[model samples]
Target: MIDGWYWKFIGVGLIIYSMIVGMLVPLKPSIELVAPSAAKTGQQINLEVTGYNTNYSGSASIRAWLKDEEGNAVLSKNVTVINAQNLVANFDIPGFLPSSDRVVPFTLILDHPVDGAMVSPDAVFITQDSISKVEGQTLWQKDIINDLTLNTAFTFPSMSLIRETIRNTFYHVPLWFAMVIIFGAAVYWSIKYLRNPQSYQYDNRAVGFTSVGILFGILGTVTGALWARFVWGSYWSWDIKQIVTAVALLIYMAYFILRNAIEDDDRKGRVAAVYNIFAFVALIPLIFVVPRMMDSLHPGNGGNPGLGANDLDNSMRMIFYPAIIGWIIIGLWLANVRYRLLDIKYNLMNK
Candidate 1:
């Protein structure tokens, strides 16, 4: 078995590491087009660009272009840098250019003196004009690559709706992960207690793990509420996941209440162990099944994809996985301390 002090040291080190990496990283420079989504043909449209980390001073060289569905660049325009975070591009839509209601994608290329070259893709320049076949040379080749220099401190992706609050992804999500791990351990001890009713240590350990797991769950819920207040416009949005999680916590809380209501030591241990088993079994469906059955604001539920695909990139995975592991180690340490304290109090009371 690993020494207790070793676990403590590892837990503290990982916690500190996660905090440092999550906060200090600078996001890659990106741009968001702020002009109208649709434009008319044969018109000179002024497009506004809002940038993040795209050091758009007067000295910075910038280029913007619109690519149609067939990978053809119909319009190449010069970018006017307004400030470090803003720019404007003028596009003269050719009358001969074929038009459709479908959105046209664009790209913005910036050469920053300090940050190096950066490219923001999937920008929009839609048109609602008549479609016509116009033969034109593709001004920009698809083979050109713009590689960004990796920052010393890895950065998180800027996403719509989440914005800077994306940083919360590191701290908030891991709490539930840690809670689940601690609770799984509690279930194991509860099963052991049931197998050997004579060993009070198993019962004590079950209680200790359950207490700490519930504490982590409570912290997770509060942090989630705070995250929702910014993203969902309310602290408690009555989301399916939120409601079910609240119900699950209440069920676990009853386990403690049930233990206290029983007076006889042996009887209390036996009953609480059984109840803990039942609560753990119910918790799986409450947290996983019930939430997925309905629409929820939370990810990984109601046909909404979670962390897979583009949501979690490699840079975030580095710190995120470590954060979960670190929190789990700390949670187990807390449970062990609680168990030893309870054991000491029981021995002293008997004397």
Candidate 2:
């Protein structure tokens, strides 16, 4: 038994080793924001920007457009940058004229000079007033408008430690993946217990995996909390992602409570299994469905998908995948140990 457990430990170690090596590989891709932001009514705004190129030289230019709340184009021009190296562009919008309505929007464009190099994100113009007055004079041209053209070379931010930190992606995403797998196992054992009261192993499996899943779930939650606090600020906010995770944890807790409420070992397993299955069903909407529909502070919502093109770069993916596999294997090893202990304690008590 000792040798077998040692081999299992070695296997888990190897999986972790693979994850570390996998995350070290590098990848490069072009990433840029389409625009700075949307506009509202009653506000004057300036666009600002920065760019980075790792390999070669790159230049960027800005274009500006003014639109109504409905996005109908009102006026457009190319900004003349006073200083390209400074990378700043300023534009002025005249106050609402008799014909001009409320809530103006602005869009900025960033163009690149070189083929291989990518331009940084474009800036956006949003106004305070969303409502527009319909009966306004359409002007051929406005005198108050000033377009600024700026030239700026692209620059890359320091990403060496960040590149290696991509392993956290695996750490963040896959422990839940393994948790999903183990929770599924828990449900399976629950169903087996309900059908056959004589089969004690099924009950043992249900408890065993649920415990392991909770342990890893907590780890994933803590790691994610740290990551969010660093990148987003605040350790806990009722963000959709965080809220859903809390719900998932609560549902599992109810499962454990239901188990303890029952006195018969046989009955405890059977009832707990039933609750475990329901918890899995509840997990789907809490973790995946509801968060996607709402405006999330996290990336991947409001027309932005988190970790898509901009957030999790290719360099980060290398380490993340391996960390997931290693953690899941380790989770299973712990589950086995728990399952065997339960089996032994039951046998001795019955004898």
Candidate 3:
């Protein structure tokens, strides 16, 4: 006999822990060079570079160099750090060099007090008019080594479109996961009620779980819309996944309307139980299957992979997994409370 209070405490603790961890971590410094992929001989090339987490406000050294296949440095240039994360580098292409279609690789190196020495190898591509080969050369070694230490605070991944809204992953995604778990439990109790129509307890339990599941589903929709508003530039994108989820929720909504339309206890239990099973069945294809078959903006739709290397990384997985578990526990706690209340009300009515 596990008490409901146990789940309540656990759910609250996990939720709070996830919130703290999801917001505090910092990202490692990364560099992106905006240099041209091709340059002509006797041309002056200027490279624009952007940095993340580079601690650009302080004094930092930035350098770039072009390397040949033989690991010899063909051209070395000093980068002028405009700010912590921004820099400009200039290179002069020699007119005497021969032309080749092959691409030349360049490297960007940043040295910061806070982030230490960050090196981005083969960071840029340049198709120059030079076919001159440097042989018997060795690779250039980094002057500064990185100190791989973890920060105490939690940080979310800084994606291009999502930006800070990536934090919503801890909240929005978990609601749907929790809703699925809660609705699955409702389907189980509905099956139990159908097996023994006389047992009002199963009917009450099914109704309670369904009610809470629907609530979670509605919350999921609202949070998803809020997340979309920031990323997609609208609250609703008419995306296939979004539309299908709305239709599925509406189907579950009809389940409650059907339950209320009935007056007799036994008949109502039998009918609602049947409807609940059908609703869950319909939900499967609408939310999971249909979205995958069509083109959609949502991640994992139309054969697109969910949480790729660029999306959810190892740091995010740390909190995301716990968030799903925490919300599921919380949803169960809500359903259990609702069940007990309905039980008490019905017992009183019998007296």
lDDT of 3 by residue, 1-351 (tens): 146377778888888888988777666555544555556545677767677666555654444555444443434455576876777767665543322445666554445555554456665565644454331122233232244333333455555556567788888889888988889999999999999887888888899889988998899889889888888789998988789889999999998899889998789999999999999999987887777777777765345523445668778889988999999888888888888888898899889
* Each candidate's clash count: 0, 31, 5
lDDT of each: 0.74, 0.59, 0.72
Least accurate stretch of 10 residues (summed lDDT) in model 3? 135-144
| lDDT per residue (tens digit) for residues 269-351 in model 1 | 99999998898899988886776667777865345423436667888888888889889888989999998888888788779
Candidate 3 segments whose C-alpha is farther than 4 A from its true place: 31-42, 57-59, 65-76, 93-155
TM-score of each: 0.87, 0.61, 0.78
Please provide, for model 2 over 97-153, each residue's C-alpha lDDT reduced to its tens digit, 9 standing for 90 to 100.
323434333334333333232323223544433333342324323332234332232
Cα lDDT of candidate 3 equals: 0.72
On lDDT, the stronger of 1 and 2 is 1
Q: Which stretches of candidate 1 lie over 4 Å from their true place?
A: 36-38, 68-72, 96-99, 102-125, 133-153, 300-306
